[model samples]
Target: MATVARTSMLGRLGDMTLPIGILAIMAMMVLPLPVVLLDTFFVSNIVLSLLVLMVALHSYRPLDFSSFPSILLIATVLRLALNVASTRIVLSEGHSGSAAAGKVIQAFGEFVIAGNFLVGLLVFAILVIINLVVITKGAGRVSEVSARFTLDAMPGKQMAIDADLNAGLLTPEDAKVRRADVAAEADFYGAMDGASKFVKGDAIAGILILVINVLGGILIGTIQHGLSAGDAAQTYILLSIGDGLVAQIPSLLLSIATAVIVTRVSSSHDMADLIGKQMSLRRAWVPVAGVMALLGMVPGMPNVLFLLAAAGAGAMAYFSREDGDEAVEGEVMPGAAPQAGGAAAAPAGGDESSEGIVPEDVTDNAPISLQIGYGLIQMAGGENGALVSRITGIRKDLSKAMGFVVPGVRIRDDLSLPPNSYRIRIGHRIVGEDQVYPDRKLALPGGASVRKLRGIEVRDPSFGMDAIWILPQQVTEAESDDYVVVEPESVIATHLSQVVTSNAADLIGPDDVQALLDNLSKVTPTLVTSVVPKLVPLHTLTAVLRHLLAGRIPISDLRRILEGLAELSGRNLPPIEMAEALRPSLTPLLLQQLGSITQPLPLITLDPELEQILIRARQAGDLDGGLVVDNGLASTVITSISEAADKAAGEGRTPVIVVASPLRRSFAAFLRPHMPDAIVIGINELPDTRRVEVVAVIGGQAGIPAPNGAR
Candidate 1:
């Protein structure tokens, strides 16, 4: 400390001679001037410096050839006017002598408060630079929205998919294609995300200026008063009103900066996207800025906060604007390969995706296209009411961890926003009804089904397409209401129609089926080939599948569940018969009980018109290779078998689930001779089903259960 002090002293001594020489020269120049005029210049010097600083700092921006000269000229003129004003004040106030004028001169010269203000501003500037640096250097996929500014910066799904593929979650070819797609998609949006922060900082910079100006003003007043060091510091803080703000220059500068930053950030990206509950709800930066602003006002802490607040505001504005869709539309994959289902086309598949890093398949199409997930979310109002179409864009950006948009899938309208009861349908067919209109029983599209609605008052003559809710109970199954024959592809939407028509299910989640699967897993390993394995309870499983559309249950675990079910019914059941033992009606109905948890269950991906098409194709033999397993056809066939086998033997009514796949046929044939107690059939052959009723079969013909080697 002593050595540093000695060095500073020596440096000061060297500079002291220059000040003395300048003073002597100044004295000579003023020797011939009258005392009043000369004193005026002295007093105004400090004032002029303050004025210049105020003007310079407030209107700062990138200098250009066109505007620089004019700015300088205006500044010069302003300084001159300030000097002239000071002279007039001194003369009119009748103040005299250098002693009294000295006070005014000292006010301009005092650096005590100004020094503190400047130091505070410098600290703020450094922090902003540091924050920007920290953000730019970081990488990875995370939600685009997060409460804390520093805690977000999530790795995007594209990045995540790449990592997963690289880690061997996918095939090489799939990885290559996905990598290209994610890269292009994430890069386009990522650029905008990154650039927005600077605008936020710029906005905050305005607040910084205002804070420093306040401190600077107080310091000048304190110095002019010529008080003791302790008193001068206290005066600026405890008694000052920031007289320099008389021009309100700092505040105006801040306002403009705020506006510009907001505009700039908003212009750069899709801002109205869901920032996740974390960022959009918590607003962490707002408090941080508020605190900093308060501190900045304190001279010691004011400047930093002011700038931080401005920057944060800028960022918020950028992230919150929902205006242009043009930018998002323009963001095409620059050199991306086509997407092939969920596989990557890389050498060793690894690509970031919504479901994490996974391998992808190479697409035969879209070699250079980016796949952006957007929703065609179903919109339904009251019975025949006007449906409000709402589309959520840029939701869950995940890049900044600021949002949680499901990757490659638009889940924006999955959950109800502005929560209220609304009707759901599968085209004209009403599938969901229990919760939709619990009190009203109106006719639906095909015939009549209006019992799902709730929290609504249905009138007797609220006519729309001639449906009536007069009963306030069940919608009588209409004669024309043919079974909704649909394929696996369109299962969810069709099932959703059931919810709309029957009021059979509600929103479901992951834990709904945890119990059923857990119990099922304890019985036998191969009993169930589940899509999602974690589900356990019957209702839970149903609900999970209902929402997620797919779920898994280990083969062993599924047997366990069957065994447990057998135990519940006090029957010694074998694994082969358990699935059949679960009444066909019961199994499908259980999905409704699970509410939304039913998953891993086959999704009906077939189109609404697909059944008709397939039927026609079957008649014309023109489908090339598509099958038609229309609605209730399987059930009606099962009923025929049940009635034939009137003497039932198992749980409720024993069902024979014929192995209709070719793979199972060959295997079942091998075991047929040894295991006579449990019947196994082949697709190519049929036995005397008159004695042993041919109950129900999936994936096959009436007589032939399955092909030789394609179980």
Candidate 2:
């Protein structure tokens, strides 16, 4: 009871700290203070500014210090309040001596400026110019641009998240977290943009306060106290300059902190570590050493200093070379893409010929593997690379969407491939291969671009959009032309993401399904026991789940899936038939992926005559053991769908086709070749809760609107 009461008291005291400090600062502006008390406050002001600068420098990212804007505002107010209090003492007590205001001002006047007001004024002017004109101005501009770009990218980012959620790459919970982070990032930058103005205003105010204190003190000293003109000028000017210097120094430190925060890139390491790693390259240091040695040999140079610098650079180059070689040998695979979290290949171990067909030598059991050529190894191997993080995020997203943990991907180098080429494999089957330049970026042109770019043109590997491989220096130029620029790492990661998501069904097996059941048993043991071998066998359950996954249905709600299966247990249905029966229960999940509940689902439909023809063809195919539709008729129907789906996509809607329940399976199978991404659903599969708009209809002869004319 005593500990609890003491904890409560401490919490209450912590809550009162900010309000009390603010009130004290306000009081300082209005009330006069003794010299001793004034000196302590001056020291405190300097300490606070130094503390803020340290925090800013140590932050890994700007959002890590989200409260910096509020801190900056409070510090600005504190400094200005101190200016007012010190100005009062300077003018009221200048008739006595420079030390009349306080020791802080007295030290700056006597020691720092050597009692010369002219030198003090010059130093103060330089500090203000550096703070106000250079650092503060540049920081304000960077903040404004960052805020604008972040806000501009929000809609696209949100749409990407929704697409991932729909594709089953992200869970609703993960999506929520990503959204909150995006909003916080935008808010942080926006606040920083506004806070920069306070520093600028404070600098201007500092100049005005100095002028007012000097003129006011001299007038009072000579006129009111009957002092000589030169004596009054010397006494008052020294005190006033000293007071301005004390305030300006702290202001300069705050300005530098603001600049550092706005310009910082979001990285896992702080500024020092990131810079250190990036600079520790043997290739970069070797040239510096050579250049320094060359300079040392030139006549009329400082040969000793130059020679010493050369020797230090040469030593750094040697050590850097050793580290790089060790990193490559240990981390990179010689003949395949190295797996991120998998076991490394064993050393030769007394010649492979003598071992003669070792079991581990010829087989890879990993579910997924990535093979990159030697030139691209740096992107997937080094501490400076972002590919590892990107791949990890992809796996996380896939795990949430697919309702199972995606296996770790193994990455290795392939000596037979071209230097810039990479291939992705699922088990032993190659899924995707592409080439990307490590030092260049892929720029996709948008509608706003008024001119063409000059580069090597190709289609985007993930989306098939027209793109160009351009030099890194051309990013700003491309962005100005309204091109969406992407780095090479993103290009590879996106392709990998699409390939893995499309094949999510192949990545799961009986073991994964059984694990899911085991985890569910902890929460609902009765449901698991009743449904597992007693009704649906584990192998049958795995097959059913693979079918649902192939159709892009998430099984995260395993309870609901099991419940639906239990209802049809006595029917003795096959896996395909069982998956079909569960569609209605899962339609709401697909609907959410299409859009929010309030947004109408955009849909396409076949005209009545076309529906009849397809239905008749399917029936005949079942009877004759083959589909007997005329080749001309099938071609016409496919062409019509391709056009409608493409048009709907251009208008920013997901292309969905609704058909009669009897024809859905056969019709979807027939159209899969041409329109692989379009969703074909039985009319009954759509829930009654969703409102849909018919955007296009194929087959126009029976008084139905044409594909181009449908609304």
Candidate 3:
């Protein structure tokens, strides 16, 4: 009980320390104090100033001393209060002598100035000038610039943190901490910017107080106390100068502390260690030694001092070089163990060396990978790097669109490719490759423009449109000319997004399918329990999902998909057949992606006669489930659809191919290779309330060949 009481009492005392100190400071400014108490407070003020300075010097970074601004404000106020108290004593008791104020003031006046008032006054003025003019002014400027730049760089830093989080390099909690640090750093610099004004004002007030104390004391002594002119001058000036020195010394310490903090850059080492390590470079010392030795031999120079300094520098350089060589020799390369014979031991197998060879177990490949050459690697991860963040956003958007979690993209560097080239892979297969200049912006010319840009002409990687790779400085000019401008990182990210979206089916497996089922089980347990594994099994469900994804239908509404699957459970239908039956339930999701249900969906339809011809080909090739269309007819059909797609895209509408319900799956497979961007939908998949505007009819043109004997 006694120990607990003692601990509780200490905690309460620690909590009250700030309020008690603040009240005391305020009390000192208003109330009168005896010489002994004033002397004690003055000494305490000097001690606190020194402590603050020492702390600032030892802090590894500015944020390590985040409370310095508040501390500076309180210290400045305390010094000013002390000044007011001392000024009152100095003016009221000047007729008595310098000792009338306090022993501290007396010692500063007599011992420091050697009883010479003019010398004391001159020294006090110089200290004020150094603090206010040089240190305070420079620190204030640094604070202003640091605050502005810190605020300006916040967005870039936040993007970098988010990129790291999405790239799996940092956890959400780690990113949160980093973001808080960035915000705190900005706040610290801003507070410092404002706190510096307190020092400046204190210096100005010190000068005013010194002048008032001296003049006020002289007039009171001579006129009021009937002292002689010389007597008043000696008495008042000595006391006034003494009080000024006492306040000025602490103020000088604080001013130096402020300068040190504002000029500091964040590092792992404190000021002393940082400076010592940087200045220990042997090459730097060697030049200094040679320069000093050359100067020592000059005519009329101080030969002995200069020559001795040069010898010391030469000795430091020689020892530093030896230490560096020893450090280099002591370093052991990874995987190279020293043997009893003082040589590296061979691998256990003895046939092959282990040096620089990566083991098979160490290579873990991601489902989706983006490998860029060295020149474009900078676009992958930095404050300004947008590729990683953009890819993360793409995955999130596609996940929502496709109704499944998109896997993370593993980004790395490949040195074998050309410096400007990048390759995107889906499960070890290269799906897209392109070149981008890091220092350039790509601008696509939409139509005839008033101005033409001079640059390397190239095709946009995502869409194969005509684009120009222009220097960054030309972006504004190109935009003014109505060209669509894109940064190099955006260009690469867009290409990767296209590749990933098209190959999303290849990325999903049984694991992803089971995860969806597990999530659905939480909401409708019986529905999931009856449909998955019990009726269709996990692999069949995965196949159904991949089939839906290949047709550009979202599986986000999994409950409805399961309801459709449950309806067909006993039928034992193929995965493609199951997907076909599920399409009607997923119509609303697809329609939502297109636009409002009330608005007409722009679509391209196949001619009835052409559709019949394709149906006959599919039926004829029924044994293998592959269409056996004539080669010439297939080429003609692809060419006609390609033209229609180009026309649809030109009119600012996506090329969605609408076919009969029976032919939707087979026709989509046939058109996928020739027109990857085309969206194919079955007639039965359209919601009843939805409207359609058929803009083009493929194979309806007069000159196209008939499919009867084109082979």
Candidate 2 local accuracy as lDDT?
A: 0.81
Model 3 poorest 10 in a row by lDDT: 326-335
Candidate 2 segments whose C-alpha is farther than 4 A from its true place:
321-367, 374-416, 427-506, 509-561, 564-711
Q: Give candidate 1 regions above 4 Å deviation.
A: 1-247, 258-407, 410-711
Looking at model 2, residue 484 earns an lDDT score of 91
Candidate 3 lDDT, 1-711, residue by residue in tens:
999999999999999999999999999899988999999999999999999999999999999999999999999999999999998898888788779999999888887678677888889999999999999999999999999999999999898777655543454667899999999999999999999999999999999998998888889998999999899989888888889889999999999999999999887799999888667768889989999999899999998889999999999897663222211011111111111111122346756656677764245467887767767756764456567666766766677788887777766666567889989888779999999999999998865566779888999888877889999899889988989899898898899888877888898999888877776787799988887778878899999999888878888888988888888988978998888889888866876776665666766778889889888888888643467798788887778877666665765666567788878878888877777766778887877776677666767342232232200
Candidate ranking (lDDT, best to worst): 2, 3, 1
* lDDT score, candidate 2, position 445: 84
Measured with C-alpha atoms, the lDDT of residue 192 in candidate 3 is: 98
TM-score of every candidate:
0.23, 0.62, 0.61
Give me the candidate number with maximum TM-score: 2
Task: Give the alpha carbon lDDT tens digit for every residue of 1-711 in model 2.
Answer: 999999999999999999999999999989998889889988998999999999999999999999999999999999998899999898888889878899999887776578666887788888888889999899999989999998898898788778666645555777899889889999999999999999999999999998998788888998999988888888888888888888998999999999999999987798888788767878889999999999999999999899999999999998773333322212211112333222234455764564476665567777888887777887887565566667767776677766787877777766567989999999999988999999899999876888788888999998777899999889999999999999898999999888887788899999988878887887899999999989999999998888777767777888999999999899999897888888778867766776677877777789888888878888878742235578877787777777666666666678678899878777877875655556778899887877777776777332234334322
lDDT of each: 0.32, 0.81, 0.81
Tens-digit lDDT track for model 1 on 458-477?
Answer: 32121112233324333234
**Clash tally for model 1:** 167
* Superior candidate under TM-score, 2 versus 3: 2
Q: In model 2, where is the ten-residue run with the lowest total lDDT? A: 327-336
